[model samples]
Target: MSENTQNAPRPIDIKLHQASRLLEIKFDNNTECMLSCEFLRVYSPSAEVRGHGHGQEVLQVGKEDVNISAILPVGNYAVKLVFTDGHDTGLYSWDYLYDLARNYESLWIEYLGKLSAAGHTRKNLS
Candidate 1:
């Protein structure tokens, strides 16, 4: 494998906190991050979320109460997240998850800014 692939971070464990709607990921390098379900939903890597090309992105709303229903392994490289709202296309690789953890604060702020700009609010999904 390539050096970049060889150095990719691996998840050691994943814990779901249903009540708090948080997914805690522990990495092999001893780093851990607690990601909100809403964040994951909004930042989904699926085609529906990302769209077909640059600037074609679609904003996701009303996912504040979204929760991961299941996590299916896609191989040694990635895992597919099945969300409560029936979105299951995104295959989150280890590198992508690590990047999400590293950039959570900025990404979340950006998401909120976009939502505000679009006059959208997080509604109850339950």
Candidate 2:
């Protein structure tokens, strides 16, 4: 196997707090990443937002009310998010979480811009 594939993250425990809108992900390697509901919703890996390919992503709107209903494990690499209001198709990978944690400011700004364009506001998805 390639080195890149061998070093991929494998989360051991994933906890989601609805009231706080926080997801505490603990990787097998002991690294932790804290992600917010708005952050996850905005950066969902779903085709609805990621589009079919690069540069075609449709920005999410009114995700302020989006909440994670469940976190379903996908083998050892990712987890499926069951969102409140019954929309669940996003498969969030560990790499994606890391990216979100690292680029929070940019991603947040992007989400805000999309919200403004769509005339939407994110309320606590509690």
Candidate 3:
């Protein structure tokens, strides 16, 4: 339980755009962000995606075609995202979402760098 979780802005609206493969979220603090489904799937905050400890992350590949199939609310704190690729474990917390939105560009760049270094490419799931 992070301190930001206690004060983080809640989502005012959440829209899923399947055609564009993005999740648009508007927060109460007037901060809005469009998170790509591929981004969310690769950055999922689950043990399966992130692993159990630092430096243990299993790099996600072939997620360029991922999309949100469903979004289920988790109490008052988070949302469970069900991805089109059959992944349904990550719980996106409000604070986490805010952080992701705020740091999206940098995080994405970093992810790309990692993928390149590992000789992996994001591909359409067929």
Candidate 4:
């Protein structure tokens, strides 16, 4: 196998916890993370959220309660996340998902900062 293929992180397990609104993922490299649905929705890789270029990202709001409705496999490389809010465009690749998991803390903080800068307050889901 090529070095790139050998180094690629693959998902060993993926589970969606509906009640807690978290997506738990374990990678072949022994990395594990629980990503919140809201986080995933806001950081969606779709053009609708990420836009067509840099500095064109659209801030996502009111997604505190969003949950995964379905997890559809995309060949052998990725999964199509069907959100409860009807968003199903972003294809979450193995690498992308691993990145998200590893960077969850920093990414979530950045997202919150952006929301605050936009004058949007995130509602308490509890």
What's the C-alpha lDDT at position 100 in model 4?
85
User: Model 4: which ten-residue window has the lowest total lDDT?
Assistant: 1-10
How well does candidate 4 match the true structure in TM-score terms? Answer: 0.94
Clashes of each: 0, 1, 0, 0
Q: What TM-score, to 2 decimals, does candidate 1 have?
A: 0.90
| Per-residue lDDT of candidate 2, residues 1-126 (tens digit) | 122355666677788988877888887677787787767876878888788988898877666657788988888667888888576787777777666665777878877887778887666532
**Candidate 2, which ten residues in sequence have the lowest lDDT sum?**
1-10
RMSD of each: 3.3, 3.7, 2.4, 3.2
Candidate 3 residue pairs in backbone clash: none
Could you give candidate 3's per-residue lDDT for residues 55-94 as a string of tens digits? 8999998889888999999998889999989999979999
Model with the higher lDDT, candidate 1 or 4:
4
List the pairs of residues colliding in candidate 4.
none
Q: Please, what is the whole-model Cα lDDT of each candidate in the order they appear? A: 0.87, 0.75, 0.90, 0.90
Using TM-score as the measure, name the better of candidate 1 and candidate 4.
Answer: 4
Q: What's the best-to-worst order under TM-score?
A: 4, 3, 1, 2
lDDT for each residue of candidate 1 in 1-126, tens digit (9 for 90 to 100): 122465877999988898888999999999899999889888888889989888999999888888998989888878898899999998888888888888899999999999999998766554
